[model samples]
Target: MLYIFQDETTSTVAPARLYKALTIDGDTIIPKVIPGFRTVEIVEGNGGPGTIKKLTFEEGQHIYVTYALHIYNL
Candidate 1:
């Protein structure tokens, strides 16, 4: 089975800051912002275009893995 989640938001903040928070500081920020996951790990790339992230839910040993792909600028 496969599940997909997508989110899009517009912010008044600087793009660089938002990028840093999403990529650089993401591992640290995720748990605090979304409390259900037991752990979050950057198992692959460093939040780059081909990066991968894993979220673990210990209750059922469920894992959700995701990767990023670079898309042309809007």
Candidate 2:
């Protein structure tokens, strides 16, 4: 469960790698960082925009997964 609602911004040790955080392959960091999630795998689409990602977690019983589509600027 999420705790208090607070605003925060953190500086990263790797600035160049930070940009990849929003990219397709960069998304693996989410499930790796976030709790409850066992593994974050790419389900469909290529790599950039419209890529659908499947997230498996312990909280949701692993039966159903949330889908996220990559949105690219260019």
Candidate 3:
């Protein structure tokens, strides 16, 4: 049998912007960093669980991940 592992990390920054080279446009930031990511797409939802995101890369790589939203009243 084989086993798979997954991890998550969260970083916080001001709601400010990054730069023209690294625009804060939606969530498609692959091509900005690599400049050859080809394409990245996201399925929009009103911010909730069960949302799906799809990504495609120039190196023939693809991935699908589901978004789970967590909310807290600070």
Candidate 4:
């Protein structure tokens, strides 16, 4: 059997602008941070749990991921 591991990270950004950026313009924001994707879109949910997001790459391939939106103050 093979095991896969995932790492968790806490990214700190200006809370106010980051919120607006993510909620308003995630497609434009994420690609700048994560390579290999040109654009992203919310396929479901209203910025809550059980949300589905789609990432479209430059080569025309698409990937889907389920996401949760949870923000905390530091």
Candidate 5:
């Protein structure tokens, strides 16, 4: 069985800053802040929409992430 999880939160940070941190700098930031995360590698694409990244943990567990971006005009 496959499960999908989604979450939403409000932040005081600007959207552009948040986006850069999560997408551009995440590989460096995630391992430092998140325990058990060994490294994050881009397995495919150029870190854009549809890009796939692999997160390897200290215990040899791996998680694959595919990015999808949604833009809304306000």
Candidate 6:
């Protein structure tokens, strides 16, 4: 079985800034703002297609998330 999810939102920030925050600087920023996230590190690949990131949460947290992001140019 397979599942996919999508979400859309509106923001007043410029597209470039938003992209930078979410993609370019996310590893550094997310763990700081979001509780339970102990660290977000790139386990493999450069910051491009096929990148695999490991997100380790604080101890006792029930969720363990890992992302293998395949980015493409639109």
**What TM-score do all the candidates reach, one by one?**
0.58, 0.56, 0.36, 0.46, 0.66, 0.81
Provide C-alpha RMSD values for all models, in order: 3.5, 5.8, 6.9, 5.8, 3.9, 2.3
Choose the strongest candidate by TM-score: 6
Better of 2 and 5 by lDDT: 5
Give the per-residue lDDT digits (tens) of candidate 1, residues 5-72. Answer: 56899999999999898867878887778767666776777666776677775576566655554544
lDDT by residue (tens digit), candidate 6, 1-74: 33465679999999999999999999999999999898999899897888989999998886677778864455
In candidate 5, the residue pairs with backbone N, CA or C atoms under 3 Å apart (3 or more residues apart, or in different chains) clash, namely none
Give residue 55's error in model 4 in angstroms. Answer: 1.1
In what order do the candidates fall by TM-score, top score first? 6, 5, 1, 2, 4, 3
Off by over 4 Å in 4: 1-26, 60-74
lDDT values of the candidates? 0.72, 0.64, 0.48, 0.66, 0.75, 0.86
Report the poorest 10 consecutive residues by lDDT, candidate 2.
1-10
TM-score of 2: 0.56
Local distance difference test, candidate 2: 0.64
Off by over 4 Å in 3: 1-15, 19-28, 44-50, 59-74
- Among residues 3 or more apart in sequence or in different chains, the pairs in candidate 2 whose N, CA or C atoms overlap within 3 Å are none
Best by lDDT: 6
For each predicted model, how many residue pairs clash, with residues at least 3 apart or on different chains?
A: 0, 0, 0, 0, 0, 0
* Cα lDDT tens digits for candidate 2, 1-74: 32333356788548567666746445577767777777767788776566667777776574647465544355
Q: Positional deviation of 48 in candidate 4, in angstroms? A: 1.1
